[model samples]
Target: MSTTRSTRPPRTLVHPGPSPLSQRWRAGRVLPLVAGLVALVTACPLLFVALEATQSGWDSAERLLGRPLIVTLLWHTVSLAAVVGLATLVLGFGAAWLIERTDLPAKRTWTVLAAMPLAVPEFVHGYCWVSLFPTVQGFWGAALVMTSSLYPLVFLPVAAVLRRSDASTEEVARSLGHGRAAVLWRVTLPQARPALAGGALLVTLYLLGEYGAFAMLRYTTFATAIYTQFETAFDTASASLLALVLVALALLVLLLEGRTARRGGRVVREGSTARPGRPLPLGGWTRPALAAMAALVGTALGVPVYALGYWLVRGSSTTLPSASIWALTATTLGYALTAAAVATAAAVPVALYAWRRDTRLARALERTAYLTRALPGIAVALAVVFFAIRYAQPLYQQPPLLVVGYAVLFFPLALTAVRSSLAQVPHGVEDVARSLGTAPLSVLRRVTLPLILPGLGAAFAMVALTASTELTATLLLAPTGTDTLATQFWTYTTGLAWGAAAPYAAVMTALSVPAVLLLTRRTLGGTRIPREATR
Candidate 1:
């Protein structure tokens, strides 16, 4: 509230409406409300799963879940995720250390190479391995492909933390008679626990919901089973029950991640007082270090390039009509760009709500959005179909429905990018602008948005790349007669036309490379990856 202040009007002040502060507070309340709505929208899949399970009755669920195949799938999913997460931790942390802490050669080139695996789509990684080596199938093959592709999720975060972290703690430990190895183990690793945990959560959650990659490797996980039930058997009840179990598994993992991160603790220091110590010189160990980096990049990146090249050279069916390929490319780009914009727009309110008010409500809203991360793409696709058919009949199987599905499935990616960008912005900047009598909207446009533009670009690129290569949800949610690059690749691969599939995969990799570079530069350079920011 405000009142006119003038010498003549002082005797009879004119009343004004809400002040900027009051208006901001009022608007702040609405953002969380919007955030809450977004969370509810995202939860549709989880709720749909639960609803279907409940409607199916407990006895039916028990009958379906007690099968040998269910147990087998459970073991496969859990074991593979455990192994991959562990491998990713070691590989990611090692690469980050080599680049940031040790005197390694060509650190800049190595950094880019280390992150290059992500430029190749996940399914492409699987296809590359199994195509080159037919024996690469089942447990070991799935683990290899997933580990190679997902390790970068861990690597980028841990690298950023190591790059920006203060090395004074290590110096103090060394001065106190600790050996170099001891200091690194005790001080450096501990300081990086948060980054490790953040990266691990992403890897683990992804492994849980992953479908196409596992399917390509002939691995039978819950995701594959769910997809089979929906597509082949048309058993919605069985699929939902299985998805409920998956949801339970996801929530359990979330709980464990929180406890593990909290237990590990965090090392915080004043920015001005922090400094990086000199890099440790690697003498005799340099050769082995170089070899390790070489082998990693080779397996993760080289095989895919080699396989694509081989298909082009050896396979007779590699050539295709240029118009068809370009048409599919346009369709993929259109949907991906739409999803990227929608997801980024949705992220702003949730990110802003949490950033402005670090309250339980804000945090809950934020986590609610992240909870969708654990869901399989097929489950999300099914849920959208369920709701659309019932309440939004017009949107069922329409392009808009596909766009919504993409937005829902990949919203977390956008949120991570946006939230991390928001973290770099100093608190009180927006308040200062508004306090100077600038309207809230004007302040956001001129002050806040400008500050987080890098994040917006990162968010758009990340979502676009991921969405473009998406297969599981796109297969289910995309409108009739529409084929993205991923779907086209899947179509040809299933028909044993490896050469035809290779071209699509190559195109996807080409499109994704720039986005991967932008994401790496923005995320690893300054922005923080998403974690338990509320805590």
Candidate 2:
């Protein structure tokens, strides 16, 4: 009898490849240089702003600080930020819970309506509400207008968290003999706290830098004060001094907010647990609830639309020329498009290097990109203007300057989006391609590019939207002859011709809606869709 041939398991394929140590060492040297460049660009402006503030002579700074009006302005700004922050937390959480958790009718419509105010710039809302009621100014007007415009920032994030939360936790609490109210108080709110807190922090920071609405309403906040000092006083030194104080205030908020954000890390759990519980029926409260909803939407969306539309129709008969509008529109589109492209491109390397090639230097570079967003648009624009005029005078008043300003102001949005999308991609796939002899550059171009296109699109859309709606920086840095829709609206409104200003406001608002819709829709759509489908 012949002995049976021994059978052996298929030999695993193994290849000796370049070691990671060698690759990392190579990247380490080059990455630090890139990181240094990024840091220099991002930090130089902040440093300059601080230097100017300190050097502007404390005598003037102290003189302004001694004035009663300045003290009152300080109080008003702080109070507005505090009150608006609290109001946003309450209104945002309540509205989000009602629309997302309760059996409220027309959840989708409510979502769209709630987020629509973002399309209406804070200034426009202030203008419209002021038009409707002259008393809506000062503290009450600032708070109401800020809340109406910003509550959505809180609502969107909280609603997303609410939709994905495991209702099973609440059900379990109820099964253990807890009441509905108890379950919510003990379980649901704790889970949603992080999103709420983060949203509140954003609202606070925005309020800190707010200018248009507060200024229009005759509210003397730091933002308005800084603008006034620059405009009325004809004193760059005092404005810089005030801007320093503003920056300090902003940094303080950011520092505390960062700690809170870190502490709430556990609340933002990754995987969804189960279908959310059905909304409690508002049987007796339905009429009152519906009426409240109507009022919210009517004031935020309806008034702006009505005022803008009425004025736009009437502007055709006035001195506002169509050619001027069209020209500004093209200028605005060019600035926005260029900014979007540059920001998206810059974010890719930062995100990719951070995600795939994690290293100390890479992470630092990524953080540097984000530093720009924290500085606020006005600071960024002003810093650039200062430097551009002093050093790169030829480039001043050029489109390229505006594009750079946008990239500096908005690269973080693109970086976050791209990095998040890249994180969702599997590393094993990249390994497989590498093992098949694909070059690193080729792999990134072919494999990573296709998967992250949606993120790039989303990022571009966001940057484009912000650039289009941007008022402060655009106001300061736009070419002498150029007028964006935002600037045009401001001009007409300031001239006491609400009828003429309405069209530009309406068009600007209308243009902004598509981007807001894209943001909310894509964001919520991603949450609603199955993860497997996303992959």
Candidate 3:
């Protein structure tokens, strides 16, 4: 009995090459460090907010938070966010569906017009409405203006998603005897869930942080309360408490979005060669639908344009000094350009880390970067003021500080655009370059950078436009005697100097036009990253 022959060959203990965990670890070694640094920089204002609140003492904060006014502010803020969010969602979704899924006349033109409201800031919209009708004030007025301004945020993304969605599920539902409306409600809308949620999140965050429009409408929301606390009462403690409450509200919305967003409906076998379904016939409903679109476009776009044109024509004859206008224009352009460049640059590392390295640390950093956008610009400015006064005295009241404030407030805009663009760049290209001995930095510079330039450009334009329109932060952090178009416009508008304010408003709107066109075109043209990368 050859027992030795029955013995199995010695098992070779072949070690695995590299586990997925080790590969991920090696790939992301530098990303976390860079992301952490960027997150810290973005979160600096938030840190200062916490520090300022702490320095004021917990007892003082509790006292401030306990006030009746604080409760009222909370109510107003929450109510406004809810109302505006719903309004924008309905309007955006309806408009997007009509244009994308129905035989809507002038669909291309309608799409562009629908998204143009984003060009007009909420404050500008408020001003136009108030000028036309002085009684437009309080909650309803604020909600109307905000809904109009922010609805475009929802429309753009929703429309883009609708455009790209495979229509197989919708057709299948129709073939199963479901009506067009039923198919839309049960199938199409579900597929657009992610876009709807994203757009709704933006609207909610905008409402939470809104100051100028609410203030102009005489609505006493948390942001307006915080502004008043700082401006009229010179009470930093009360303001910080209010800001903390606002931040909590924003975090609540973010949490809700995170929980719901993951349930987004995705198409099965999206790579299938199924053609998009034809637009459903509007038939008898065409005229009414067209009328509705007309009214929406008129309210959101026409009135503002008419008002600005009317004012510009009326103000052209006024003998106000041209030097101040030119100077303010120059200052606004310079500051906006600087802020856009800096913020876009700062967003690159964060976007790269979040997209390339899908880890908890990377996601946390990305979330931290967006926190500032959820806060009032005044809160961010005050934090910067506190930090500058206490630690970096020399930086206080400097142009650099003002730019830093803009960067903090607008960095998320750049991050969104850059991240979307980065997602489109194929990972295999970078991996192949790496395999061929190209350094990571060189690959980014040579391959990745060129591929994402359009996105970066869009980001720059978006940030620059927003920074130019920024009111509260600019008012707070701007150097003494520094006057941008926004500040000068605010100065005149507050004094009922309509003739004086008109020019600055016109100039500001003019400056925003190019950027707005760039952004609207990019969004409407569907500059989305591949689904695989985003997931």
Candidate 4:
């Protein structure tokens, strides 16, 4: 007789203590409500988009969407996303392979450098390229800047997966007479398919709503057009229509990403006996491989630094009062820190709700928060403005209002970080704590939060990093007279004062480094090295 083994992962039972109904209710009630509320808050942007678009009649939408410029911009958006998406996957995957799987020189140093581009803001990347080579100001230029800045999104995930994944499958294939190349194509890539699909989705959705990079590169995408319509033309009807188009494009990307992920072959991750793939010796390929890695880092990270240095040296305005710069830096830090705290705190309830209960509603609520992530910064900013003006007039243009916007805009990111952390927690640890006559709140405070400290740290750092660099939203939602480094940088750049912008850019890059380091350490720590492999 054959015994059947279930493929499903074990369900984390939340039913602990008293009656099943009481336990389920105790586990869920407040958590579900809190998570649902968070989900609803995140959906504010989508709500605003829908309502604003409705303000335009079918005729207005027809005229707006029918415009040749609109059509061209849509095509521009799709094409750029495709190019950048493909380029990032190839570069990201190749770089991950070089750093994680190949016997590259100074692997640790290379790993940090590979993830360094993420420290540079997207707009800063564009500014660096455009300021240095003014000729780099079109589709290709935009692609180059975007690919450089965003490739880390793909690289980090792929590298993390590669670092942790078992090499036994590849070894078995190799022993079956398959070459290294075949094993990689068949075994390794399949394992990383989910990560690749997720990364592609992020890159594509970001392009759909991106304004800063394309704007700086002089590339007209739908996101930029929407910004121009809203900010420049002050035409809500037209802007809303364009935003709807962007949302549609984002949905299409989501659908495609889901489909790609679904079509992927099953990933095989065996238990603890599994071992990491050993680094393959490069042999004669070492020099060429080194050259390739150098070129990538040089273009992606080196150019930005060189450009900033050149501007600092040449710009007569580089001496812009240190007091002023410091004040702006302080202001930026304050806002970023506050937003990070708020976003992370808000995420806990949502993440906890999903963790405690695996119901459909809980899952849907968690997913709802992610939808706003696909929106452009401008769209999210506008949504905040729309709601703040209508519902909470006092919050309009207030400091707290901007914090709310940041929380809403980056909620999904925070949720992901927190949830991932919570997922790693030993199953029923919280329940076991509660079973010991501890109250739910105490168990959460003492047991749950401690277990997910790393995740919380990662979430806080990531939110702070992104919030500090955020431009489009800050420009719109900032209270009157508040100045951030991003806004100052944008101001100087727009005025052709690259010299003045250099300091802000430099400082912003510096601020991001610690956060990047923390995230890398906490979120994607190095996998354990086997004794034999190390020898």
Pick the TM-score winner. Answer: 1
Model 4: CA > 4 A from native = 1-24, 262-271, 317-323, 522-524, 527-535
Per-residue lDDT of 448-507 in model 2, one digit per residue for the tens? 889889878878887887788778788878888778888887777676677777766777
True lDDT of residue 324, candidate 3: 78
lDDT of each: 0.84, 0.73, 0.81, 0.81
Relative to the true structure, candidate 3 has a C-alpha RMSD (angstroms) of 6.0
lDDT (Cα, tens digit) per residue for candidate 4, span 95-203: 9888878899997777788889989999999999998899998989999999998888788777876776777787889899999899889988987777788788777
Clashes of 4: 0
Superposition error at 76 for model 1 (Å): 1.0
Clashes per candidate, residues 3 or more apart or on different chains: 0, 2, 0, 0
**Clash list (residue pairs), candidate 4:** none
What local lDDT score does residue 290 receive in model 4, on the 0 to 100 scale?
Answer: 96
Please provide, for model 1 over 349-458, each residue's C-alpha lDDT reduced to its tens digit, 9 standing for 90 to 100: 88888888899988777776777877789889989999999999999979999999999999988988888878878888987888898877777789999998988988
Report the Cα lDDT for candidate 3.
0.81
Local distance difference test, candidate 4: 0.81
Count of backbone collisions in candidate 3: 0
Q: RMSD for all candidates, in order, please.
A: 4.1, 6.5, 6.0, 8.8
Deviating ranges (above 4 Å) for candidate 1: 1-15, 264-271, 318-323, 523-535
